[model samples]
Target: MITFESVTKRYPGGTVAVDALDLEVPDGRTMVLVGPSGCGKTTSLRMINRLIEPSEGRILLDGRDISQTEASELRRGIGYVIQQTGLFPHRTIVDNIATVPLLKGWPKAKARDRARELMDLVGLDPAMARRYPYQLSGGQQQRVGVARALAADPPVLLMDEPFSAVDPIVRATLQDELIRLQAELRKTVVLVTHDVEEAIKVGDQVAVFYPNGKIAQIDTPQRLLGDPADDYVENFLGFDRGIRRLAFFPADGLDLQAGIVLGDGTTVEQARRAAKQAGESWVLLTDAGRLPRGWAALSDLESRDGREMLAQMPLAPYGHTFRVGKDSLRAALDATVLSRTGLAVGVDDQGRVVGVTSYERLRAAIQAAEEAADGQGARPS
Candidate 1:
């Protein structure tokens, strides 16, 4: 929904913040601008809303040139978020969030209602509406900033290092929140950051900028990591790009073994026999509903006294286990890593144990994804 056509930004001192750049962010997708300091990633974002007018060429929103539109009107249609949140210290959270809506001539009641809705949408407590910015944590303030930007539900959002100032844990939470919000709202989003990992995690398409404000490459996160455009791009992605590719691997491609199963009421001897018959070291314990509860080792069952109960033995909790659908390879690999035997106990959404995927199978799945990506690249453009 946003397009930069040969756009360039230059200061009075002849410092070009953005070189002649041509970029497009498709409707309902995120395009991340990432690079080291002074790459002009942030400058490029500011130009979209005319926070900084371009020195050359034009920026188009949908089909019309934003340069020709009134600055206030243009900004109202595009949400802008910055790193520091920039909330008004004296205003309440609701009042801060309602700024744009209120400025646009919305009624006080309606604007505040919208503000409350946005706060809830961004995962903040509605009760915080009356609280001032100083009363909230940094993370809470950021969420309020996000709510303010999204108050009018703009189709386009410009986030300039919005999560950079927060702590790592809060940054991760915000990242997850952004991902979730994108899935639901599908706003045309342009996010700027120097962190390549963050770019990969949040970007549908990543634009790697160079020192002179030039774009090195713009491609999908998977393609950018799997096949970098140049040595600089490769280095920026780090030497561990191959390992990072594992996150994209699906679990369906892995071969799963038939799980050794036991009902909750099954006797210890019965469970032990089942484990031996299946030639497995552990048996999956399930309730009468056939939902997975935990796992029990064969040795533990053998050493148990006659009166001891299966539920009484030390059993690993359920949440620690991972479950993947029949088609997801990544989830299966994650489960394998968490499993004691390097084998993922595959369970359906209903929590019934379907099978188990071994580490060997996960390795094969990784190879398959790599080969597929390579094969696609080799095809004619």
Candidate 2:
């Protein structure tokens, strides 16, 4: 656990970076410090590893005063990752990951072996072990940096905008990877980021930093979204906070209508009759494997002269599918909005369609989710 007791960082020009801050990061959980630039979030992170000395107050690491320890010694025990991964350009991936372990007097073979293990742990292939940093992609290099941090098996990890340097797709993949790693390793993690969405995605608890090194609010991401502390925090969370809040609510038990679904083998006339019977303007067409094919409008089916194969007929695209057992309400709603038939397709892990949810049903789910969150006095974690 890390405890900040009235910690403050004052510059030589009498400017305060962090002012009278008090915070606690519990063990084996991720705590994300997030806010706008110059809000002192980075300063607070640096102070934890003594990269930036505090001008006032004390910081305790597992109840030991960090100031009493040597800077290099303290940093060696805590893994740190940054936006621009400071990898050694001259060193191979394995040597880079084994740097700290080698410095700490581990045998070269043992350190290299540990590096190989971490390479696999962070999703890097063994083929890249001998390659230099320049030979790897931006995402791959970031993985190497993470592997290097975990090479020594540090109990605490500090990350300052670690995924900010990558593209959005890669950034999201990295974020998920970090979450997966944290679940397996359970490291005490304090990550700093300006992206509120990223903080919400990865943090167990999020700290919203304000100007002058003050924390505006600190709470779980769901709680923070369900009930913002003030206008500033709410505005910083962006205008789509309500939609974001839905991400916490599971979509498993959502009521789905399968009556509107027809198989691809279903004839155009059969589809027309089924759509008329169900009173739906559109019918979802599925394949023999129960996978969603597309949507067939009732008018389109009716226009056909005879029993034309539904598979051969023109159909509206099925935009996307959400995993009913795995995805959230936000995903289901997104699927519904993207769909041409105004219905969201719920699928299992194998991408086979389970059923469809309408916009009205999604709205009811949202209301129920909000009411449940309110009744519990906190949103789902």
TM-score top scorer: 2
lDDT of 1 by residue, 1-381 (tens): 898999999999999989999999999999999999999999999999988999999999999999889999999988989999999998999999999999899999999999999998999998899999999998998999889999998999999999999999999999999999999999999999999999999999999998899999999888888878889999999998877776676565666666476667777777777778877777777778877788788888899874566766777654344455543565566666777755567777776776666677677778888898787764222
Clashing pairs in 2: none
Model 2 ranges with Cα > 4 A deviation: 264-279, 300-314, 378-381
Q: Evaluate residue 189 in candidate 2 and report its C-alpha lDDT on the 0 to 100 scale.
A: 98
Question: Compared to the true structure, candidate 2 yields what TM-score?
Answer: 0.91
Error of 1 at 42 (Å): 0.1
lDDT of 2 by residue, 1-381 (tens): 999999999999999889899999999999999999999999999999999999999999999999999998999999999889999999999999999999889999999999999999999999999999999999999999999999999999999999999999999999999999999999999999999999999999999998768999999899899898889999999999999988999998588878878887788887777778877888888999999988878888777865788888898888889999999999999998888789889999999988899988898888888888788765333
Off by over 4 Å in 1: 259-320, 326-331, 371-381
> TM-scores, in order shown?
0.85, 0.91
* Candidate 1 TM-score to native: 0.85
| Candidate 2 local Cα displacement, residue 145, angstroms | 1.2
